[model samples]
Structure formats: structure tokens, C-alpha cells
Target: MVNNKTCPGCGVMLPNKNLEFSDQYNASGECIQLYHELSANFIMSPDVTFRTQHAVDAYGAQHSGNRVKNIRTAFSLIGLYLAVEREYTGRQVQHAHMELAKRNIKWSSFILPIRPYALSVADVLNIVEVKRNEMLMEWSKNVWDTWENYHEWTRNICKSYLKHF
Candidate 1:
């Protein structure tokens, strides 16, 4: 039922059936318009909601510093996913720990410059991508080497560890 028109928000092709014209002046053109408005308001507002405040407060209680807490939260979420879905254990855990250690170093280097401001999720992702690129460039200096070795080694370690479990 899709027509040739593209969505004004995301710029992808829009379905013809879902596109409706209303006589009312104030009616949003589509669900995408409502979503865009909500997202814009969320970004424009400086004040955190009560729920976010409570969550931040609870998170702060366990962690001594803001950066450390945020990084720890990120790691905890990653670990949960790996453990629950990936079923990583033993040497897999060790491998993950090593990777996380390197990532922490990279994150620390990136965070020191931006520590003064309260960062949004997008800000953190941007910083991470920047640091990751920097790390990759540094790694690529050895022209004879390939990226597969690191991954293969980690996989071997994981396979070995999985044998015992």
C-alpha cells in the first residue's frame, strides 16, 4: 500500500495507506510527527524527570563518583547480556574482562576532557566511537598484522573455557 512519497522525518519511503489528510488544522500528519515532537521536547528540556532523578540517586549511592558510576553501569549491563544470553563463562569471562579493561582505558582517555559536563547517552556513544577509532588507528600501525588474530585468540579461549562447562 506504500506510495512513492518519502517520510519527511526519517526520509524513508512512506506507505500510501497510512498517510492521511485531516481537515482539522492542529492534527498531526502522522504518528512520526508526534514522536518527533516528543523527542524534541525531551532533548530541549534541561530538567530531569522525577523517575530519572530517583534512578540517578540510587545509582550514585553505590558508586563514589559520577564517571565511575556511569561506566560501571554500562559494564554491568553488558555483563548481564553476555551472561544471560551469550552464556559466557570461565575463559570467556576472562576474555571479556581483558576487553573491558582495554575499553576502560580508552573510555578514561576520552572522558577526562568531557568530565565537567553532564553528558547525554548520545554524547557518551560519540565519545566511545571517537576513542575506538583512535585505538583502531594505533593498532593498525603494524602493517603485517591483521584484526583476525585478536578475535581468533578470544574465540579459542572461549571454546576452551566452554569445554569445562
Candidate 2:
């Protein structure tokens, strides 16, 4: 039997065979596997657009640590902010990401929480199919809430760069 590996970031355990994985973001092979499972739910759903966007932001933000690039982390947090605060749909957040990418907005580095996520893709996956979407949003919100230190910065950046979107 294969041994299980634990993700240092979110504390999820997955079966491991010592395969190569990204340590920069604390994404173990198991963590990526869990993410893939989460993605499959959205990918196979009729409401793919909204759920996909949320999964992207939620997973991205939850996984981002000091080892993650500032730009990518900023994108993740901004996406979360727009989705949760502004009630932007997944499509709108995607457009906002594109718009922000075009501008010269300076993305600031965040001092992410030591444990960036309390909930993992596994948590969402465990919920009943009918309530999965709600659980996904809850996961997103929980991840976003952990990055509370950067809320003002995220808000200001969106306010300045994404006002028209």
C-alpha cells in the first residue's frame, strides 16, 4: 500500500508514491489530485462558468504562500475579492483579471496566513452533490477570509484598476 503524504499548507493527506510535486506553493501530488477532483465537479456541471471561476480563485488563493509569485497571488486574491465582495460572476472575474493584466497596477506581496486554508478541495468533495456548489463558495470565502490582512489592499487595487469592469 502507498503511504499518504500531507500538504503542509492545508493539512490534507493523500496517497503518495514519492512523485514529483510543486513545493513552492506547498502543492503536494495529493493536493494536486484533490484539486483535480474539485475541478472535475465544475467541469462536468452545467453551471461550469460560475463554479469554475470560484474553484480557480478559491484553490489559487488557498495554495498561495510566500513561495508563490506576487503577481499570481495578487491575481488569486483579486479574483476572490471580486467574486465574494462585488458579487462578480466567474466570467466577470476572468474579464477583470484580463483587464488588470493590461494595466500597470503594482501588485503587492501579501504575508499570507501560516496556514492559508482551513478547508481543502477534499472538504468540498465530501459534501453531497446537491450542496457542492454552496460548499465550494464556502470554501472560497473561508480561504479569502484567511487573507484578511490584504483585504484593504485588494479592495483598493480593484477600486482603482477595475472600477469600470
Predicted model with the maximum TM-score: 2
**lDDT of every model, 2 decimals:** 0.31, 0.80
Estimate the TM-score for candidate 2.
0.88
Model 1 agreement with the true structure over 50-103: per-residue lDDT tens digits: 112221211221121322444443333333233333544423544554566553
lDDT of 2 at 117: 66
All candidates: CA RMSD (Å): 18.9, 2.2
Local accuracy of candidate 2 as per-residue lDDT tens digits, 76-146: 89998988888888888999989988988666666768644678888898899889988888888998888
Off by over 4 Å in 2: none
Tell me how many clashing residue pairs each candidate has.
0, 0
Model 1 lowest lDDT segment of ten: 108-117
